[model samples]
Target: MPMKKKPTNICCFLPDEIVENILHRLPTKTLLKYKIVCKRWKSLISSTSFKRLHENKSLENPVLILFSRQEGKPFLTTVDLSGAVLDRWDLASIGLQNSAFLPSPFGSDNLLCLVVDMQRFFVCNPSTRRACQICLPKASMHCPSGISKASFGYVPDRNQYVIVAKFKGRRNWRMITLSRDDVVVSAGNIDERWKIIKDSARYRVADGSPWGVFADGILYWTGDADDRRCLTCFDLWEEKFFVVLLPDEIVMIQEYQDDDQWLVELNGDLHLMYKKEGQQDIELWKLDGAGDWGWSKQDMCVAGFRARFGAHFRPVMMDEKGEMLVYNGGFMEWYKLKHEVFRMGGKGYKNIHCHAEDVILDFKLHIDTLL
Candidate 1:
């Protein structure tokens, strides 16, 4: 009598631990490929274990992920800073959306973006990994006033965070706040169901640009004043508007050229990156604790920047101590320690490009590996 052949079961063949180990490293795209391998793999891939594992491994070092590469179309591949991947699957896969996008994680939370090209925004709970999309009312869409800048923030004081979309629509510069408590209706909620908090100052919406930042319960942005655009700040908690005067350095820098502004946190203080020259001569203007952005050449304490300034360049903030990381011409380069702008590390993204195919290349400090 011949022994019955053992059933060709893949799940029973490999160690459960080994399969999961391999699954953790494979990206979301590759996971889709393995779904057909066996029923067990399909189950494991969709299990909460996978999501929890990714979240745990993600907290160590921030990843530099490349997002939105078109097939053969050379779109600027965004280094997706948000922890979880955002693709066609997230909205539809989770069953909470229809061609709607969510805000990509902003600043440090590993969640940014509220969605693109659509008048929708997502409110998410990072700790629970749960999210919901909100639609505004249609009447609010035609914004008799135009949308100037939108900022979302959480205030523990009120036990509710708000999605504050600043609008300079036809009427006034109003602050539109939405919260879960504002979910008056269930399934069919309109996107414009927002209540307008009118302010005394009517901010202008120039060409419908959505550029704004939220810090310490306040929203800051660049606004037009007397035909000249300057910095503007709004307090969500206080429900008032104020202006932050540009530093002499920042003001002078803008006077001579385009008012290029970028925001980042340095040593916990919010900093405004104003570049009047190239990356090599990029000056650091102190936005807080020191003074306004107007730094004097005599105050910089650095030398040789006046003569060799190139204003056309990009800037990146890094946590890699003494290692300022930047991707130049699609290649990753690091600036040397102590020096401001000389390319140091040779580990360039020579082969990386924003191609249509799905691939992920990211970096993190090795220190967290021990965690």
Candidate 2:
């Protein structure tokens, strides 16, 4: 009989291209866990090409990430639009305790930029559950409390993530910028320095969390002086500040208990959401760049909302299907366009009263991926 050769290991004989194709189809969590399977798998997963492929796949299946606290522990939970839980990443592991993270955290691509303890700054990839605490510049030490306004955004021109913060003191107002590297590296290896921006606008940053909307390389925040409302624009590239007067029809309504007004970015346009003085409906105004300084009114169906929640909820977002996501007393409620309302969280979520405000503070549409 002819000599038979021993059978070779199947996985060892697998080609690199074949292995990557199989791994690409797997979910992010599985790929992350599979990295420890072997050295080869780890090396394949950590490659730049594989990361780019994974990110493209992630964009197809986007998930809403809510920043909430459970039993005094701050946790980032990923959920489907139907309110089904997919995964939960405990932020406590990264030292974010007691919901200390700021609200309306600016998210671009796959990263979240948040402020912690009102002084220190950090950029986190919630999908990968990784965070790096960045150091503030030397100027912050002398005027720690001068950080009146701050936000994070991506600058395509520089191919970098820029952090914009406005500092106010007794004498002059200063705008600072910090450029974060695109590649992820150790916190120690990164330089978190602040550079002063030369501008003369003395607009105080509005709201506690990130109340600004970042669109087209510019960070916009609503500012008020002497009951006159205006939009504060910060050019990320030019590193300059300018103010635009808001339309007379739109008014800023303040909810003493919690903030009801919001600056939302929808379909690459800036929008403002607020309730009229005596109306039971929520109003939306979109900025019309075509016209010379004007905000066009948008018609939206809030009948289903007022029927159930009675104007107590805040409109979070509107999907392509015309379904609207809103927040009510800390509970997420989904209302179809001119349809009925469904409460996302079930009855066992009574502890939500204390954390409802915090939810809106730092929540954004977060995607789950290995970034």
Candidate 3:
């Protein structure tokens, strides 16, 4: 009699392509744990191509990432629009202890560029709990107190991450570029990585604008001079600075306090949200054509909320149904465009409680991925 055929494992019959498609759909945490399953699975999951695929899949199910600190311990919380918590991460677990601030307004490719204690710079993948320290120039390291402001962005065409920073008592801006492959920079090659950007326009960023709002491959900050009242634009690709004039209506308003206006990115377009004096409504001006200086305005009403308090709220995410998730200093609230009302702590909303002293460092929309 012939020997019985040996039993075969079902996983072995699956193609690498099929396995990859299945694996990419899983959460980053699951994939990270699955790395120990086999050498082949580990190699495939850790590849750059697989990371891109996982990130693309995550974009379809994005969530809000809130960075806050309670009693000096930093926390990163991921929640949906309904305020349901999905995952929470303690930044101290990844060696980010006593972090003075967190990356605000935006993240590139789901990767966060963080500055700790205004001195140590780090690039972190929050999903996989991977962090890399970026090397700064000697001047910056020697006098960390001089580091006034820093903005981070990704250049898609070149596949690089760029950081532009302004130093106190310095006219020229400094920049550091990190390639996708070189996520970690060593101290030995610091000089070769940092560059000094020539400021021909002599643009000065406003004092209150510490972080820039990045949109369309450009980093924008409020201009310092009152006469100018414009936006200082830094093109990442060209490494040049230019000025974009603000709308005449906003500039002409006599009671327009710099604090009343906030720059945010909505639907991939730059929007300027400004509140007029003695008005309960806010004006949202969308930048239509940067070259032609085209702008369209829409009024948003937030009833029962003071204009001063409402001015701090900025839209972080918008859904297909025209609902928005707006962030104040630390908390988040939902706004329904059709109903024109803010929703919080009710039947359809969840309340995020925090102590009076608890400080919210920053918040942004993030797609948790292996990257």
Candidate 4:
């Protein structure tokens, strides 16, 4: 007997554990392509354990995900904080048509969550380009008044992705989820159905451009608080609401308008950005519980910022070196708060013209390695 000829299998030589270790580090694009190699490969890649492993590896290096609006269209791009484009993906190719695009893409465990015209929910893997549209449950159907605030977050305890919608009509709360396959469908069963949470507080999120910042399993929004505006905190784990007090100066300014105020989460702490009515200096306040209302203040100066400070420039983030990232619709640059100068000086700060003369720049911290 000729020993039945030694088997010849390229991928079969590696153990399942080794294969999973290598595949988890590969980009989503490559992994999707590899799924067609064989049934074993497909099953392995599609397994929940493999997905959890991939997500864990991806969390290592975070990138800056940019949503640039040009000519009323939205483009999704990823770049490192150092100002280098890594991957550029067109939203149109993924069925994101002429709909009203949400500002920044929300990051979940293994996917990025986006809203279309505030009517549809799209969860996609930025790396693999695999997307699934989640249908809004009937319970979450159009509110007579309107949808005041909507946000998507992941619950680690349940290992599920949830969309929390706050309606303006009855001031009600609707919690919706995607199916096991990640498709949006009307709640079919108890597990996949929408649950309404009764509202207890009189607090409400502001109307226009209310951005949701998810940090430490809680979603934070900048909204109204009686005559003064304040930070709204929603605990995803508890499904409860809490109000965070903004700096005295911030509350005073926000009471007037929303353009000048921004809520951002940096390095796990909530940050509030605001510029007094006539000050050239922009102050960034961080929640400093050890200090005051868990708030600490840092200021930055921009030349002629007061006269030119409309919506073009917004302070979005700060790095460990104390350099702040300033986004101006079309381009992003780092400003050394301590040095009082921008990385590119004046020329480096020049706007990278987009198709739309007026664009909105939204930044979501992305993990470079994950994609």
Candidate 5:
């Protein structure tokens, strides 16, 4: 007969770092289950240190979290790859009370941005949980149409940040480039005032491909022209637009081309994942140089996958050791050596709060805007 082994209490024997290493691999849903497995897990996993571990892992495998922008009462819902729920927060309470509006966050390092209203924006660090709100007449003056998207990009030429808000209505709306120098500044003025650079102007997005990613000192947008969808690459340094051809296989779906959906920079290359016609999977295109974008296809999804899923899987910059972290399929998933993938789960954070409109855990990561 097999020896009846006494119940081993290994958790107490292990170091906290070891425990966190194990905990970091669990899916958010599984983490929820593990939290109830025992008191040790419940206490150990809830500490700020454990959260810091997860946060560090997140900066490694940062998951792009999208929340439902409810009108008047705005809130964000997030989902992982395994279709797990994390948490959702009410934006209204945080002074982002425009429910009818869209809140898009661009993330890099510790700084996450939140685009509030049409022109206004905010940047926050999830690890420290500190946020800075943007105050400006330009942001407050412009109100975008119901269907539009906005982005925040850095201009190398000016050594400043720019907020680009794109609005789409009956016609191809306009582009409001909020430059720090554009707003009128008072000479030696102490009160908040800005010096405008370029007056806000409107132009039709070429073929309706809409805005792309801002990468390598460029703000990229997409437009479909002449029955073909192309990437409208804008040079922030020179203020010019360059068009690049998209793969013929990919249909270049319209809905996912919004400001935050497409364009992911992975391993120093831009990845464009889009839906293809009559096919279930999405296309993965890579832009390595200034020339044409290389394309490939990856099924890489179960049911309910989409171009919007790209937003949830944006690549988080690697840590000093060069590892990327992300939440895949509703679980904790991280990248190793630019290709290997791992799942990191947490306790109780899974299924924390979720619904149809709201998916995984609600963790918001925003990008920086013009100040």
Candidate 6:
């Protein structure tokens, strides 16, 4: 006969701070399951401070979020740089079928804003399987053409999430702010939450441009005003609007003819990308300094796959090895910086093509976390 030794307790050897540091590095899915380990672990995982810590850790290895619709159901897929699937969510499981996800360059605190039936809006956290429907003002709800331009962003200073939108035939923009604690609110008395922002600058967003690119607490839109192409910037903290003029070279290029141009946030700075039709090179202009209003230009040659489809691509994210993940409105491919060639088909590349039948609604770099 032998005596069985009691199971050793982990808390006796490891401190609380060390335990939290170790848990923060775990994946969101694993952490969720570990919540049942004990009461202490469950409380630590669900705390607001812990969620913020986990979010920062996740940012180091961000993934690509593909929002698409297949068979009339919305699907969200997260993939790594190697084109490996990390996670997938059938939004219909959470009663969000046929919803359109609003596109934002920098995702809003791991939360998604979805538009349902062109009238109702919902703020959802797919990781936690929680969603809250936001009530809109009467004027905003009656738009015949629905919301033309909309963006969802987070304000770090105020710890609030804001939604900015413009409806058809509306001269001013409408906005609603939700604090972190009030993200999921009662829909009974939310009508007065929306406010109209007067457009003293009279900035009109371009017809076919994407919604908005948020960087450093500001939302920017590519548009033309006063017969000139400029950037309309809305400061979330100040609740004011300003214009940033494009470089003389870019303006000259736009004046001559129409080019495929879009705004993106790269490395926490706003970048303007444009490629002329029938050209193999794409031009990128980075805003050197927001205060100084300086611009630096770089050209990326895309002759690797131009012979086949002749499609242009935009940089979505740069990996640790300095390689770029680019998207061309249809498919995503990696551009090896050292080799200067695009990697289309390989071992990991097939994972993306597996979902080719689904209609891609939006794609962006996102950091998935427990929050």
Error of 4 at 233 (Å): 2.0
Local accuracy of candidate 5 as per-residue lDDT tens digits, 140-235? 545334335444566545545554444433233223333333232222321144333243333335433433456666656666456566666655
Badly placed stretches (over 4 Å) of model 6 are 1-22, 105-108, 139-145, 184-188, 253-259, 299-312, 319-323, 328-333, 336-339, 343-350, 353-356
In candidate 1, position 40 carries an lDDT of 89
Name the lDDT value of residue 274 in candidate 1.
Answer: 55
Find the 10 residues in a row with the least total lDDT in model 4: 183-192
Query: What are the runs in model 5 whose C-alpha is more than 4 Å off?
Result: 1-90, 99-110, 126-147, 155-159, 167-203, 206-212, 251-262, 291-329, 332-371
* Tens-digit lDDT track of model 3 for 1-371: 99998877545677999999999998777898888887888899989899889888888777666677877778877765566676778887777776644333344464677776666577766676565675446663444345677777778888777888876656678888776445533335533577789753387778888778777778888885557588887888889988788888778777557776788888777888776666666667887755675678854554534454454565777666767776666566777765767666452334442335546667777887776
lDDT of 4 by residue, 140-171 (tens): 55533444577766676776766777655655
Runs in model 2 deviating more than 4 A are 1-10, 13-18, 82-86, 98-108, 168-183, 187-192, 207-210, 252-260, 290-293, 304-307, 310-316, 327-361
Report RMSD (Å) for each prediction in the order shown.
7.6, 5.3, 4.5, 5.6, 11.7, 4.1
Off by over 4 Å in 3: 1-18, 80-87, 93-95, 98-108, 139-145, 184-192, 299-312, 328-333, 342-349, 352-359
Q: lDDT value for candidate 6?
A: 0.71
Instruction: Report the error of model 1 at residue 176, Å.
Output: 5.9
Per-residue lDDT of candidate 6, residues 125-146 (tens digit) = 6556456776546753554356
The TM-score values for the models, in the order shown, are 0.60, 0.78, 0.83, 0.74, 0.50, 0.81
Stretches off by above 4 angstroms in model 4 are 1-26, 35-57, 69-73, 79-90, 98-110, 139-146, 177-192, 253-255, 289-293, 299-310, 314-317, 344-361, 368-371
lDDT at position 102, candidate 2: 36
Better model by lDDT, 1 or 3? 3
Residue 102 shift from truth in candidate 3, angstroms: 5.9
The residue-by-residue lDDT of candidate 1 on 1-371, one tens digit each, is 99999779767778878888877664444566777888888888767767557445645433443433233221112233332332232333354332222223233333333433345565543322345565543462463333345665545466445555654343445444444343322434535546666664466433433555555565656566665555566666777666666565555443433345555433333456555554334455544523243433212322333233333222344444634444443445554435545553343334334343733222211111110
Candidate 1: worst 10 consecutive residues by lDDT?
362-371
